[model samples]
Target: MGSVELPGPPRAARPPRPARAPRPRRTIRRRALPYLLIAPTVLALAAVLGYPLVDLVVLSFQDMTRRELFSGATPPWAGLAHYRSILSDGFFWTVVGRTALFTVACVAATMVLSLLVALLMRRVSPWVRTVMTGVLVAVWAMPVMVAASIFRWLSDADYGVVNWLLGLLPGLDFSKHNWFENPWQGFAVITGVVVWGAVPFAALTLQAALSQVPAELEEAALVDGARPGQLFRHVTWPVIKPSAVLVTSLCAIWDFGVFNQIWLMRGGQPEKDYYLLGVYSFIESFAVNRYSAGAAIAVLTVLMLLGGAVVYVRQLVHLGAAE
Candidate 1:
């Protein structure tokens, strides 16, 4: 009772543990780490690419001729004159249409073939998958110029392996057939080269994405009697869709700017029919000596590419955030 009486005095409430100070420094560091990591890349890209882009845009607004270039005279500004001329020209529109069509053909073919190859990789034995992966890596590692050269040889009119093989088909002869004589057939060969180079990367990417699909989900769907197409649409496609969209966007950008295959195939002198935006720009600049016009075309090409670039960046950000 005495001890209880001594405890009767209300003990001062223990001071609330001082609220922990917010570690502003650590919080800042954590927030800043990502930007810091990417800074070098941003700086390097700026150093490498910034000046050219700025110069291109400036040049697009000027009237620069080869005469001025050779004489080392300052180019005169032309405001939107070059853009007006290009936008008004029917031939420019034709080239734009052709470029669009070519890009679609190449991208569509590449996505289909790559998806098939990726699915095949999933179905094969581990050794087969390994072999396929090695082949894809080898193909991906091969330089674009070298691949273009090989395709040139393979499609050579006189001694092409392709022509020889096609000649073997009964009631058909492709021997000494000029693939580039018809623009349609020529573009088909070009599409083949584009798809060949593109498929390996896309297939590899899709294969990696496919690996992340939940097996349990697929099995459950199968057990529920889902058809193959239904299974893919419901279970497999969702997992791979992001990768596919990214790949398709990239393919669109690349194929939209295709130049090397057409140029090399046509022996560095692509015809008017073969003029994608890049080829058109080159022809306008060097071939026709319209520097300002070329720059304008380049600007337009960049604008067209922006849509795909935007899609790619958004998908990449989504992927990063999801992880």
Candidate 2:
């Protein structure tokens, strides 16, 4: 046995295993960095937007009178009394119609004008494009209040530039026209202002979209004996459809909840001409001291804006599917 043990081969030693590279350490900062960046914005929105929204919801359901609001009493459950009142109220319906008309008119005018401007700008020389852009910027740069003031003066019966210009025209009589006193004229003025204000953005957006149309595509259409109008319909229209829809959607949304422009134009006339949801709500809350009623009107307006957004989303989805 001893001899056998001596004959045993020398024990072979294994070589050392190579060391592995350490995995990258994830710090609290590294793991949470993305969330941290967004957390502040989320928190801010929660405090500012979220709190007020919740408050408005609660305010909408709970009855709040100026007297009760001023005095510190918990409001009793109004249920949908405010909403019911708004629904039954004749004035409210009138304002609803007015707002709808304004929205429609503004959308139509803005779309048509913007499309035309975009088309022209898309094909013009650099200097011409620059001039167009400069003019748009100049108009767009004016403050809302200033623009409103200008419109107010321009539409005035006593000293309107429009009336003056109309007087100059051979067939027109503008001796004393109160533009704000008539709903139709008021609407026209409002729509004109809104469209004029919106055109620059639409033109810029549409021009960019038009620029993306391949030159070859248009050239090919021409080679195929396609006239300018035919080429527009068959080629450019499809290419610009998405952009146009986006602009339209935006215009719809904006006009749906418009406040200052319409309010300023309405000028506090209880007459048929002087009512829009925004103006009515302001009058109710401030002039008449009907806080809950005003809140109801506000809620309705919000629903309208929300509806517009829903429509926009649907259009965008449809467009995506089409693509």
Give the alpha-carbon lDDT of every model. 0.93, 0.82
Model 1, position 5: C-alpha lDDT score? 39
Instruction: Output the worst ten-in-a-row residue range by lDDT, candidate 1.
Output: 1-10
Could you give candidate 1's per-residue lDDT for residues 219-266 as a string of tens digits? 999999999999999999988988899999999999999988888878
Question: What value of lDDT does candidate 2 attain over all alpha carbons?
Answer: 0.82
- 10 residues in a row with least lDDT, candidate 2: 265-274
Highest lDDT: give the candidate number.
1
Shift in Å, residue 120, candidate 1 = 0.7
lDDT of 2 at 182: 66
Off by over 4 Å in 2: 1-42, 266-272, 314-323
lDDT (10s digit) by residue, model 2, range 170-232: 999997898866667777888777887888888888888899899999999999999989999
